[model samples]
Target: MTQDPVSIEPLCLDEGHALGEFYPLKQQAQAEDFPADPAACRKDFLGQILHPRPGNSVLAWGARMGGRPVGLCAVGVPEAGRRWTADVVHFVVHPDVRRTGIGSRLLATATGHLAGLGVQKMTAFTSGPADGAGAGDAFAEATGAARILRYQRLSLRIGPTRLATDGDTGAGCELLHWRDDVPAEYRAAFAAMSSRLAAEEAARSGSDQVPEDFDEDKVQELYAVLRAWGYRTYLTAVRHRETGLLVGYSALGMADSHQRHASQWDTIVLPSHRGRGLGVVLKRANLSWTVEHEPELATVTTWNAIGNPAMLHVNESFGFRLDQSGARREWTL
Candidate 1:
């Protein structure tokens, strides 16, 4: 018997909301504890594009298994990260639609557009830690993409009490930390910093990673989207006394933005300023802002490579405990 073909089209605002339904389902199926509200799904989807770090476009697509939306895949190519490479930002299909080729179809559409944009390669990330089978292994295996690195997500509890920031001074050194917006001037700086990130990523690389190689203009687009998301929350930077360069910077915001619990988005320090501990300084400043301003914040989470001890130490000082309790398996293509 012949089955109807799945239609495909470029994503637009109204149509894209369809992708929201898949969020909780994917979460539930993967973790068994995902929340039931579809509204949370919409908030997360809209937030990614609207604020803090908007990077890619999406699609509203699915198949009719007896005439219902049963699959969804969002292919996003960040405007700047990983250069022109595209990424499988989100991909999930109803278990009922599992064998119908819906996943592949979505992959094809997303990759095609990205390739058109001059993206040479594509990278994807999805993980699972299901009951001791190497968490993300199942999904990673299904996709056929090789798993190069597995990032561990961790969190630090911000105690109910306030912390100190009196030690820091804003003399010639401007501590540019603001969440609601990124200074218009930093948009250009972010792009430069983004372009420069390619080399920086290369220096730390031990596995294949995308977005790590993003360029400057892509960074600018991301900043624009982040500003829209009300995530313009944690953009912190330190300037040089003589050169006035944005020598070190950190971006902090929430992952589940509606959840109020903050998380580290991105942070970097110029090789020129590495010895100065500005990376920690930049991050600490942001944490101070969060604890001082948002008392409702519960936990602030971040992930770091197991091998990256320097940062792990900084997180420890701030009380971020290793999320040894949580892990995810990954699938890549």
Candidate 2:
């Protein structure tokens, strides 16, 4: 018997039911390496689809065989700089449908749409070894994309203990802690510091991509999206006491009080503030705050580029263990 023809359709906010159908395929795709929390995963999936970050747009497509969703792909285009690039946010094909043309067709459709928008390149992330023969790795290679970077996922088990609070954070720097919003007095400096971090990362990666200039409005938009997904942001920043400028910051995010897992977001220290052990100070302070606030939290996970040894050392000192490996692949259009 001949197999039924697969159909690719656009997934939009109005089609919530159809979008939800992709959850099963998502679960199956990640089952081997990353067992997901059903409730949290579904909530996060729907939340991202329903409420995207401000100044960004997402395009999703679903593949159906005889009216059942068998494959899914979603791409994101930023509103500001880097308009020539796009991110392949999520891409998966059901196991039963392996080797079928569905995956390729879905990608082609996405690329065609993006090409029309004048996007010159696209990037994707795969959750496996860059050299391994996993399905995700194989697919990326088959698509002629280069594995540009590799990252290690680390997790730290939390306990009922208080982390050390005192540390050398430079001669005249003071630490500030806050939940959810940046205080009014620090908003402008915080935005500038974030923008600087973005530029440094892009330059370090040898990419000419332009960084987004963040402001008060952009920060609020980020918080709004996090709130829509039922997440709380915990931040720890170091301010130069005499200069009254933010020199470093670290942030952690929790989905809700009920979830036992949280994720470390970002940790950045200004170039001038390096070699003072500020990274350790910022991370320890933030983790202490996270543990104190969330009594049920068990594990906190983070991802670091394999090249960043300094941050890795800090995480290792905190007892974080390796969980898995992943790679980022980029394709030029």
The top-ranked prediction according to TM-score is: 2
Each model's backbone clash number: 28, 0
Question: Residue 258 of model 2: what lDDT?
Answer: 42
| Global lDDT of model 1 | 0.56
Candidate 2, 205-264: lDDT as tens digits: 644556557887777787778878677789999999998899989999987534688899
Model 1 per-residue lDDT tens digits across residues 124-166: 6554332333322554566565554455566776664425652
Those runs of model 1 whose alpha carbons end farther than 4 Å from true positions after fitting are 1-17, 20-41, 46-60, 77-84, 95-120, 130-136, 166-174, 206-220, 229-232, 255-257, 324-333
- lDDT for residue 45 in candidate 2, whole number 0-100: 65
